[model samples]
Every structure is written in C-alpha cells, then in structure tokens.
Target: MVQENNNKGNQISRRSFLTTGATAAAGFMIVPRHVLGGKGYTAPSDRLRVAGIGVGGKGESDIAEFAKGPADIVVLCDVHDSRAANSVKRFPKAKYYKDYREMLDKEHKNIDAVSVSTPDHNHAVQAMAAMQLGKHVYVQKPLTHDIYEARKLTEAAKKYKVVTQMGNQGASGDGVRQLMEWYNAGLIGDVHTVYCWTNRPVWPQGIPWPTEKAEVPKDLDWNLWLGTAPQKDYVNKLVPFNWRGWWDYGTGALGDMGCHIVEPPFRVLGLGYPTSAEASVGSVYVDEFKQGYFPDSCPPSSHVIMNFQGKSGDIKLHWMDGGIQPARPEELGPNERMGDGGNGAIFIGTKGKMMCGTYGMYPSLLPSSRNKEVNVAKTIARVPEGHYVQWVNACIAGYGKKELSAPFEIAGPLTETILMGNLAIRSYDVRKPKASGNGFDYPGRYIKLLWDGPNMKITNFEDANQFVKRNYRDGFTLGA
Candidate 1:
C-alpha cells in the first residue's frame, strides 16, 4: 500500500535558499578526514544517497550516471519488474520496490536525493513528493506533461527549498554555452526568428487507439504504471515506448524532442512564456475518401508558430515535427547538412544566422566559414561533470549551495513555452456541432491563440484553455 511520508525527522523544513556558486560542495555535512580512517578515505557524509524512480531505459542510464559520481544508488523503484531488472542487477545492494510511495515512506531517512525518469505524465508528482520530503530531485526533460504541472514544480522548487534540475542534458552542454557567448557578443545581432524541426513519431501517430485489449504482463504492475493517467486496459507494444503519440500518457513529438532541440534558442534568447501560439498540422487520410480524425493521438506532422516578446522586439519561433523541416538558409552549401540531417534548430538574427543539432550539438554560423573566422570569448563556464554528475554533486552540496544548469526556474518557462505548441495543436482538433446539426464546424482551426502567461489562460479561445491542465486519475494528485 502507498503511504505519505510525514516523519518530521525525515523531512527538510521549508526555507528560502539562494544558490550562488558553481562548485558542488557536500551539503554542510563535512567530516574530518581522520574521523573516517585515513587521509585518503572519503566520508559517507560527502556522498549523495540517491533513490531512483522508473529504473529502466533512460531511468537506468540516469541512475548509472549518478552512480558514476560521488553518489550511492540506494533505492530503486519502477512499476515493472522486467524493466527494473537490469538496474537491480547493476545495483545489487540497492533496495527495490514497485511503488515509489512505499519506497519513499520507508527509505526517506536514508535518501538525500531522488532521480525521476518516468513517462512525462508522472514526472511532476514524483518530483513534488520527493521535494516535499526535502530530498533534491533530478527529473527528466520536458519536466512535466502539462503546463500547469510545470508552473507548479517551478514554484515548489522555491517553496520547498530543494535543489532541482531538469534532464535536458543539452542545457549543460558546451555547445549551448558557445551559442550563448556568441549571442552575448552580438554576433547574431538580436535573433528575431528561430526554427526548430525534428523527424519524430518514429513510433506510430495519427492512428486510432487499439480497440483490442491484451493480457497484462505478469512482470508489470499495470495500475502503478498507469499512475496519474486515466485507467485503461493493457495494450500491446505501448509499454516501453509508443506512448509518445497519445495525449493520455505522453506529450507527442514536441514533448519528446522539443526540450533538446528548442533549448539552445531558449537559453541564448532568454525566452519565456509565449505571448501567442498558432499551428498547422498535416492530416492522414484513413482511406481513399475519408480523413483520419484520431483526436486522442497526435497528428502525422505539425508546424507550430509561437510569438514571444523579446528584449528588442517581437520574436517568432517555429516548431516542426513528423519529418517536416524549414527551408534551408541561403548561406549554406548545397551539400551541407542542416541540423544534423534529422533534428536541428536555426536562429535568424538581424545580421546573421546560426544553427545547431539536437541537444545543442555542433553549433555553427550559417555560412559555416564564419565559425573559422570569428571567435567569441567564452563567457559561460562549462560543467565539466556533465549533466548527470553535476546534479549528483549539486545534491550533495545542498539547496542554495550551488547553481544548476536547468533548474526549474529556467526549465519551467522553457517547458511551458514548448508545450504551448502542443496546446495549439490539440486545440486545432476541437470539434463542435453546427447550429444546423448537419455536421461539425472546426472553429479552432486557422486561428491565433492569445495567451495570458501569468494566468496560464488562452484569453480569446476558451476551448483551447482546456489543454492547459488535465484532470488526474482519482488515486493520484499533484500534492502541494
């Protein structure tokens, strides 16, 4: 059975924390070297004790990365035994559980931090619960499944006074830092437009929900796996992946790759919640005569345009997915690859344009020749430990002791900005009965949505607002 952690001794009291340094010092738990055994011995207090939820696939890799640093992987939790098997075998001494709540209830006293790498829908709740217990959190990219959840996690990071980091590893990459330095140097000359594209939905999309149900795998705790999402019977081939196309469990292509592809621009431009959002989606024809209307699944392809108020003036950002891409910049050579061929982003400024591949890799000038001619002095310090190790060290350093690359303060707005596109895409499919009652009218189509960032509302489009926050299943809640 699941249990709430209320033990005072296990919880860190709420307090205001302001981190200033980049160094990851062990969080106020320093011990004399002689106290342990010898000069070369490291004290247990210096290591961060971490518990991992969703210990499979990316989660397994995330935990392993943390283990590579001064962190001890002590507890492992996942809804499926088969998925957790590899991690369990690797971290043989670590305790294992299928439910995260039970693990936290019993092991909170031993854990100093938590790593959350579950599906997008479960990210917020798991991270929130860990934070409320005073354990620092390192959550996977896109932060949360919904805009409201992202906003709340941002606020909670401050209210709970816990160190937090998002798993958009590119935020910690040298490439993004290079882009920042160039932008700060005025090389790009005020980026007014940006285009990010991806060839995603490598899995199925724009398809109907499976009508047939399959027997639940014995190794899987189906109910727990469905945490926070509406209850539904088991479906084949949706376990490890393919959930990205569904609104109920995943955030589609934008959510899957947006954090990695759009992050460089967000960092370089200091972008926040968009002022307005609009989108156009490509449709899939079910048969020779009918267009497919799978409202529950993402479109085959989509192009979303969002308007943001930048430092100088208005900025327009475009997001493309499902193999769609923007026109090639004129400065590039005919044989030159754009954005690593499959995924990339281009920033267009007053003077020039720059582009980068996914995860902000391989940032370069439009002509590619300028990269050799012009050199900007590096201003931002790189994280030598990389994204995962950096988080582990920061957790040991405690809240307010060290700064993080993608803390919720920055990640929240970035996530909300990226998800704004999804909101517009979902809103586009809103169907309503016509006054004559003969057929449906697509009122949400071909319209720009006005967004109130502070209030998290679409002022002009009432129907679009529904996508901002979704209802959770009865057993789950994003607790304060």
Candidate 2:
C-alpha cells in the first residue's frame, strides 16, 4: 500500500549541506551511463550537427547554449526571419529556413539533432518529424500543445529510439536533483499533493479580439507560423512572444510556464496522469473584458484544482496564474518572498517543504525553524551542478541518458499537468458551460475523463475528450 508523506519529522538537527554536485561530486552515487542503444555507436568526431526550428525567444537560448557547448549548429528555421536573425547571428556557420520541412528534407542526414522551440502547437509535429528522421530532438515544454499530443510524442520517441529531451531546462538544475534525492530517500514520505503557481496573464488576459487585421511583417512568413493551426489573419498581438495567450498557437499561462514551474518535483516524484480535473478560471474575454487583451488563443487567469487518485491517496495539484499563490506553506523560511512576477513551485510535503523561484531548481527554500528543525534523509545528497553541462556531457560523451535528469518520458506527463490547466482555462470559452452555476459540473455532466497512460483516450466523455485533443490542420500526426 502507498503511504503518504507527512511533514512531521521525528527528529531535528542543524546541518549545512556540503556537496560537490548531485550527479557526482564527492559522495553521491552516480548511475551507470551508456551511449544510445546500438553497438557501433561511436561518439561524434565532427561537431554533432544541429538545426533549430522556431528560432526566436527561448529558441535563441536553446541554440546559443548548444552552440556554446561542444556542438556545431548547422541550420536555423523559423517562420519569422526577423525573429530568427539573432539566432542566425549566433550560428553564422548554419543555413537558415522559414519552412522547417524544407530544412529537414534538405539537411536531414547532415543534422544529428534538432532543437524544437516553436509555439506549443508546433512542438509535437517538429519533434516527431525530426525523430522519425533518426535525429535527436530537444523540444521545449509544455512538451506538446495538448495532452494527446504529449502522449503521441512519448510514443514516437520510444519507437524511434532516439535520444530525446524536453526544453524544460529546470530538469537540469542543481536543486531539482537534490529535491529528487530527498524523495528517493523517502524524506517527504509518499507525497500526495503539490501546489504550483506562476504570475502570468500580462500579455493575454481579459482583452477582446483585435479590432483590425495585423499585416504580416516584412521578414516573417505568416503561413509557416500558423503551421497545422487553422488559418487566421496575422495580428501583431499573435506574433513574437505574445502567442502564449492564444488558443491556436499557445496554451495560455499554464501552457506557457507549466513545463518549467510545475515540473520540478513532479518529475522527481513521478506524478503520472491526473485522474479527475476541474477548473475555476477568469478568462481573456471573461467578465466582458476587464483585465487585458482578449486574444482568441488564451484565457486571462485561472485557479484550477486537479485530483489524481494515486495508489496511495488523492494527489491534488493546485495551479494558479495571474498574480495568485496559495497561502505560503508554514514551512517557508522568513526570507522567502511571494507575489507578482515570481514564477516557480512550492512542494508541500507532510513535514517540511521545498520551494523554487523562476529558475525551477533555483533559489530553493529550506526551513528556518528555531524550535524544531526539519529532518531530511541522511543518505540524500545534493543535486549535480550545471544543468546545461549535464545535457551537453550526456550528448557528447554519452554519460547522462540512463538517468537523464528530465528525460521526455517523464517531463511529458508533468507538462500535461499544465495542459489540463489549459482545458480548465479554455473551458471558460466553452459555447456551453461545463457547469450550470458557480463553475460546478452541469446538473449532470456526462463527461468523465478517464486517462489511461499508454492509450491516452478518455473512456467516458467522448465528445469532451475530443475537444481536449483538438484537431490539427492536416499533416500533423498526434505522434505515434
């Protein structure tokens, strides 16, 4: 039987953790490392060739970090040339493309890996196509635009047997590893609930649809940006970075940051599919448009509660965006801060708690209990340092895969946790409400979403489930 972890430590002690790193510094045990399956798998003598799709914003960072590592970036692909210019500058040796498909067909063999940092909607398509070409993939999170997409990507990675990683960089952080170790050592017992929040909703909130059509920018190929998304006229509000708040291109605040913020310990603790999901949100066109711009793509803000009936008990994940936070856990240090602009997660265990700021595994909090100290497992060690180096070393020397800090298999579900939030948020725009009064299910809501991991289909709520799955513009496979 699964036992839940309570925050009541039997004993207390004062100890300052001193470690070289989590993977392997001084004392921690390092898991066995192996190159990708296949006998003749020789390390790359030529810089592992790369191509980057959706080459702007976070994509730039993804490219820069890899190029900065022991790799040679050979191709840059983005729908908008102007947005991709800086990335092109970083990889002067690489060719550029507005259409990623053409880039793949032409440079397929020449490329060993591809970084997919496109909007949520394009991630599954780009990453899956790259993997089918026998290329390694690094796609940004929420791994896919929706839940079924996440499952599809997972299956593709497994079948293709390519080394894959998600772009939730927190998966590579020092504190993230440490948090995992604490869980592995049974510090938090069997954790049943997690509360994660982010301060988003700045770009796309309660604002209404654009009053005028936005002319396509000179350098951008608008058709490509709408990849697989239903056709729509280009609007400035939908371009560059503001796409997160839209339905066709993004998954609102939850989809925007869930991959980074909610994923830290969820990955560490192994939070599989959530059983039941319900929401209470304030959207972009909500309340007749009060807060911000109401882009058709996203909601204003939401406070969603999901209950997953795990083997142990019910694990409730509380998610909020738009300047909201659960009351700070009793375990936080006095120095820790909360409020607007802070983007991170707080893992409230049965006894003590762990908290993180914008950086995922960074700025983590420990208790400052004078009366009683929170006890952690003596064998639990700190996380390995340099999340960036971890992935680099793993890719180059083939050292980190067996225990990839944030392998796509794990992070996908965590990102899906956020996708559920998208469902909750977007439900506000449901032509027919899910509930009749006060956001409760309609007098007799017929939809019962039963998510089976490997299958990824809702046994009940057939129509509602399909709505959650969404229809892609032709040519987009839901992965497997």
Candidate 3:
C-alpha cells in the first residue's frame, strides 16, 4: 500500500514536517506500508517517487536509469526546456518545471527523492535543499564544484539521515570489486604510486570567453540556468557541453573525468585526503613569444601530483589530462594499449601493477599471463543491477538500512581528493606584478601546497584558499 501522510489535511511546511519527524520516535511520519507489514510483503507505495533536477543530456540518462527501477519520475525540471524535451517526452505524465527551486519547494512533500544532474556549480545548492527537506538525493559526480561544497553535502547527508549517492557509477561495478579482491589477496601488494590520465577538454579551453553575446533561446531560462553562478549574458554553444572548459560552470577535465578515473585507486587502497599537492599546467601560446593564462578558463592540460598519507604509507598519485600519459610500463607488451588509449588509471604496487579504464572497467594486472594464474575469492558483493538501481534500492530500503556503493560519505572525500588537483591547477596561474616591473611574477609556481585536510585549507598558500569555497551570488546560499 502507498504510504499515507498521517498529517493529510494539515499541510505542514516541509521544514516543520522534517523537524517533527526528527523528534518523533519513528523518525518519519509517513512510514512505508512495508515497514508495518513486516518482511516479504511488498507495499503498493514501494515505488519511489523521483524528481529529476536537470533532465537533459546526462540528466536524461540518469532519470531514465532511475525510471528503470521501481521509481516513478513524477517531476522533471531543467533550466532549458529545449534540452529537456527528450525526457519530457519520455515521461509525459511528469510535471515540468524550469526552475529546480520551484519544483523542490512545491513538490517536496510529494517526491521521495531527487536526482541532481545539473552543472557542477549548481549541484551543492540543489542537493542540499532536497536533503534539508528530508529527501534522499543522488547527485552527479565531481559531487560539487568546490571542496567546501563537497564537504558540506557530505555532512548534510549524515545530518539528515538520507540515503545519498554520487553519480560515479563505477563505484557500483564489479571491476572495482575484482581489483579490490586482487589487492586484498596480495596480488598487487602495497600500492605506492598511481597514475590517472584523460584526454578531455575536447571542448575549447585555454582561451578567452567569447566576446559576442547571443540572444537567449526562448525555451531556455537563462538566469535560472546560471543558478548560483554570477549573472552573465548567455554565450552561444556554452549551454550543451562546452561549459566544461570554464571555471565558473564546469570543473575542467579533472572534474569531468577525475571521479571515474580516480575512484578505483581510492576504493582499492581505502584512500583519504591528501597531505600536499602540486601541479604543472600546459600553456597555450597566444603568439610566437608570449603565452596566455586565462584565469576564467582551465588550462589545456595539467599534471598534478598529490601526496596522501595512508595507513600503510605515503602514496604519490599523479593525474594527467588533455592527452598527457605516463611512460609505458615494462610489464605490458610493446603493442598493448595504455589506459584504453585515451582515459585510464595505473596502479604501481610493490608486487605488481594493474590498470583499468574509466568506470573501473577492463581491470587487468601487469603481464597479461598473470590474469589466468590469479584466482581469489570474491569478498565484495556486486551491484549487478548497476549504480542507479543500487541507489534506488537503498533509498527504498530507507536511510542506514542498506549499504550504498557511492554514498556521499565515500563520494564526498573522493570528490574532494579529485578537486584538490584543480586547486593546484588554479593556483599555478596566480601571479603578481614583479618588483622590477618588467614582467609578472608567478608566485604560485614551483611551490608545494601543504594542505590541512580536516580543515579544508592550504596552509602554505593563503590565496589558494579562495578557490576552496566560492562566494555564492546574491540570493543563493549553502544554508546551514
């Protein structure tokens, strides 16, 4: 049976309802019928009433995956109606809204969960708002644009006692589990260094913003699309995908693919916050003699090294993007592909090395012959239904009832670790007028940034802290 709100006609505000729920012994006024009926009895209201925040592109796919499970996509929201057309068509019964805030505010009581697949900048605010209303949330990867936002969302998940998951589906895959088993069996013993690389930024980067402004599409709510980002005129072609190149809306390649590529090592090694970070960015030459550094844009490429003090020992992880790759390992054949040709990860351990592609797929230990020789008992349960279904099942199972593969508790730290590379990339461009007045002095260059993981600050460089937590534009805030 569908869970009925005990306070039917009272129409209590979402905040009041949540507060009452917290103080109540049951912890929730609307208990699922299954809980009352005991095990083996499926409730008619067991179907999760899901609301999607950005139903376009990846958002469309995310919603579709949820819909495949015992979920009803009741509300579909997107800043650009044109971008959301596909999802709207798929779920004709779903109520449509251009603004997520309005959708969440009006539908908070009706919806069971929210799936946030919006731009990086808007992720934290939307997810936090839903969590505040006591709704479970599944946010897309690179969980938030900034480290502080990632940290806040992580804390909010626990505070609200909501089932949370980040969109890095690889966390739910069997490949990561296979790798974990291999590592646990002492096949790849004590990984000391790791390399993750991606050939991204296929979108334009290392360039200035377009000078020409374009008229906003009639179907697109430009301001709503901007969300917490500073108000700016809509630029042509920035909406669909190219925004990944900019610092304001997207997090460049690191944020784009880091979650997928870095997740394996994090999961396998039980990694945590890094102690220090440093980076070198590739520059785009504007002229024969001069190179340009666009502060508003991410560099064309970058190589970041982060040092994590693990329980076993210190780990040095290298991140390379924009076609940069590490040297070929001697164990693999000369013709063997390194990192699935474009994006992949390599783990160097005391015993051997293993590599995998994005989403932890195609895991293979060094020396292909070892694959047949190694056989270890599977210790980790596999999410065969996949990442989205795992989250949906967990949400239905209620908070603290079932284990999630990429719960915010795990994804948040992974996101923070991924974004720390971006901090180094942005800091690498910090410059001031030189004392001689001939050229600018890049003070951020050639310095290792010491980090206080618990505090979320760069102890060595004060200026770098600005990127740790961005200032939300007027009206939007990461409310406590």
Candidate 4:
C-alpha cells in the first residue's frame, strides 16, 4: 500500500492541540502555574495519555518507552498479573485490569492512545477496540494474526481517523533509510531478487499439542488470555512467551521476524502485494520411520518464495527461517559475516547487491568495502527519538499532522505480505484422502498458489483459502 502524505501543508492549531490534549487528560488536570504561583506550567496540551494492553515483557518496555516522551501511562491491562508486575510497580498510579475489554470500555475516555504488545491472536481485537473508541493505537509487529484482520485494522485506522503505528521499530531506523537512499541512488540497480533469512522458532514447533493440561496460573485469567482463539486448557510455557509455535496464537518464525527483515526491501522497492506464493517446509519425524503430523503447530523450518509485481518489473522475494541462509554473494568475502551472523537480508539488483542485519541494522554493499566508497545523499529523514516516542509525538501532534514510520496504511500491506508466507507454510501441510482411500495427498505441497491480493484468495487451491480469514471464537469480533 502506498501511504498518502497526510502531513503535507497540515498544521496543528493551538485549539486542536488543546482539544486533543483535553481528551488525553480527561478526568484529570495538570495544575497550572497561575494556581501554584509560577513554579512552572507545562500545558496538558503538550502531553499524551496512553493506556497499554498486555503490559508485560515487550509490553512493559513499550509502555516505559512511551513514558519517556510527553506521554502518561494512565491504564494497564494484561491477562497475567505476575507478568504485569514490573509495569504495575513502575507505573503504580496507573489503573490495572486483567481484561482489555473492561479496561478500554472504562478507561477509553481518559486516554488518547492505546499501546498493544500482545500475542498475535489478540492484536487485532485489542487494537480495533481502541480505534473504534477514537483513540490512536500503537501495535506490535506482524499487525494481526490473519490476513483479514490486517486488512480490517488498516481500513479502520482511516475510518476512525486515528493515528496508527505498528511496533516494527526498524522501519524508523537510519539503516533502512540509508538502504533506501542507496537503492534510490542506483547503488543497487532494480532489485529483482531479495533474500531474507532468520534464525528463529527458538521456541518449540512441528510437534503435537501436549495432551496433558497444566493448571492455570493463579494470577492469570486463562479464558481472557485465549481471547479469540478456540476454548482450550492451559499449556505449560505458553504464557509470557513461546506462543509463537502454535498456529492458533503465533505466526511462527516468518511472522516473528518477517516484518523487520522483509521491511527494507518492501519499503525500498515500494512493494504492494504478492501475485503468487509457494513454500517448502522442513518436517519432523515422529520416530525413525514416519514423519510427524501436527497441523496445529508451525513447521520446524520453511522457505517461502513470494512473487510481487514491482513497479519496474517482477520482484521475487525469498523468506527463509530456522537458520536457513541464502548463498553468499560473489562480492562478499568468505570471511565476512552474512547479515549480523544469524539473521539478515540481501537484495540483488541488476547492477549490484547489498545486505543488512536484522532491523535493517549495519547495511553495507556486497563487497563490504564499497560501503566506504559510496556517498549517497541522505534523502529520507531519520527518527532520532526512535519508534516508541515517535508514536507518542505523533499522537500528541494529532492525526495526520505528522508522519509515522509504520502507520497502518503501510504496515497493513507489509503484514499481509508476511502472513502470506504463513498461509503458504500452513497450506504446505494441507492433505486430502486419495481416491484409493490410501494414506494422503498433499495438494498444496510443491505447487505455486496464485494469489488474488485485493480479494485475499488463493485461486488455484481451494483448501488454502481456509486460512485467509479465520473464524474467531464466540464473543469476539474484529469490531471494525
């Protein structure tokens, strides 16, 4: 998706600033200096009041970072009280709740923005709720669990007229802009092929669900944690982390790091949606003889090829996970590391190649020495305040008054591109009974699935379409 430049010629008036400020500081006031006799009077108009959902771990850090700017942590929500302890301790004055639904319903008027750093499954619901309340939202990466959710949230951002930003901090980094400038400067000419690899799924995957159920933590509301996912008993090590391996909760290694890894090429090339997708996955053997069948779990490893119709020509992007790295370019020295050791990306243009580490960090020309020789003019502005604070400033500046690095307008398509890889990975295991009623036939395997991007479908494969939009459990909706 091409983002419209909403910042052009738009200015924030003092009246609009105060109006937005009052909404953020609703039910509370920043004492004016006139009342206290000239100590200081920072206008509440200068601040943004933010409520955080899933305020633990990454969420904890997200809230803390937002607090570093002109923003206040007014409310916090998380399913597990134990996980939320540090944030609760740090923002003691902030009200705490276990259910995000209740927290937003009660506190929406008091906060101008919502920060969501929850699991992949809950991201859409939580973010959509906040946006529906006319509040700006900052969501963690991958944006949503399914393609449909990403599309809905993207549209809702514009519909609600809210400021939206995804939590892929790399989109705001200097490295990506540098890569963009180099590409724009023709240092790398017309990238037709791209490779993005990651050493991830550091969590368990490609295994059957544990038959045994663990007791729910005393502090955790298991039902709330499940959210839109199917009803199920709690499993050990599924909370605080490790949910990434499950199909119901996480988007696997591709989703875990794709936004950060694939973003550089996507932005530098101005990519839209992929026209086709095909993937091959690494399998796990149950014993010594038979391969395991765990459709609910993500594969141990995968390599997906996505074909996008770029502006200049067709661009083929390759996504590899679980320690799979592409062949080193001829220009790169054998001793030189590829993409920060374990994770990185490489772009192959007609004239040359360039690579970067994860989060678009440490970008360099293929020869590595060429980086020192090239002096491209910096065309893109850098986010010195970093990603989290950028959102806070944008929220304070009001909607469309300032530009964001990963606004939903841009992030939605990037997320769809990432999830498209997952769709292929999931479809890789799709099976059907053979005519003889024999073992099985995996039709989705080794076949290029044609994509109808705007319609969100795999035209050639009917079974693969099942994953395009998931059915949420009862009592949950996208709420768009």
Kindly give the stretch of ten consecutive residues in candidate 1 with the minimal lDDT sum.
9-18
Which residue pairs clash within candidate 1?
27-396
Against the correct fold, how does model 4 do in TM-score?
A: 0.92
TM-scores for candidates 1 onward, in order: 0.92, 0.79, 0.91, 0.92
lDDT per residue for candidate 2 within 334-378, as digits (tens), equals: 565742236767666665566666545453434634214544444
Candidate 1: residue 300 Cα off by (Å): 1.4
Q: What is the lDDT of residue 74 in candidate 3?
A: 93
Provide the clash count, candidate 2: 20
Q: Point out the higher-scoring one by TM-score: 2 or 3.
A: 3
Clashing pairs in 3: 1-44
Off by over 4 Å in 2: 1-46, 184-188, 283-295, 331-335, 339-341, 362-366, 370-385, 396-402, 428-454, 458-460, 475-480
- Model 4, residue 124: what's the lDDT? 97
RMSD of 2: 11.4
TM-score of 2: 0.79
lDDT for 94 in candidate 2 is 86
Better of 1 and 4 by lDDT: 4
Error of 2 at 62 (Å): 1.0
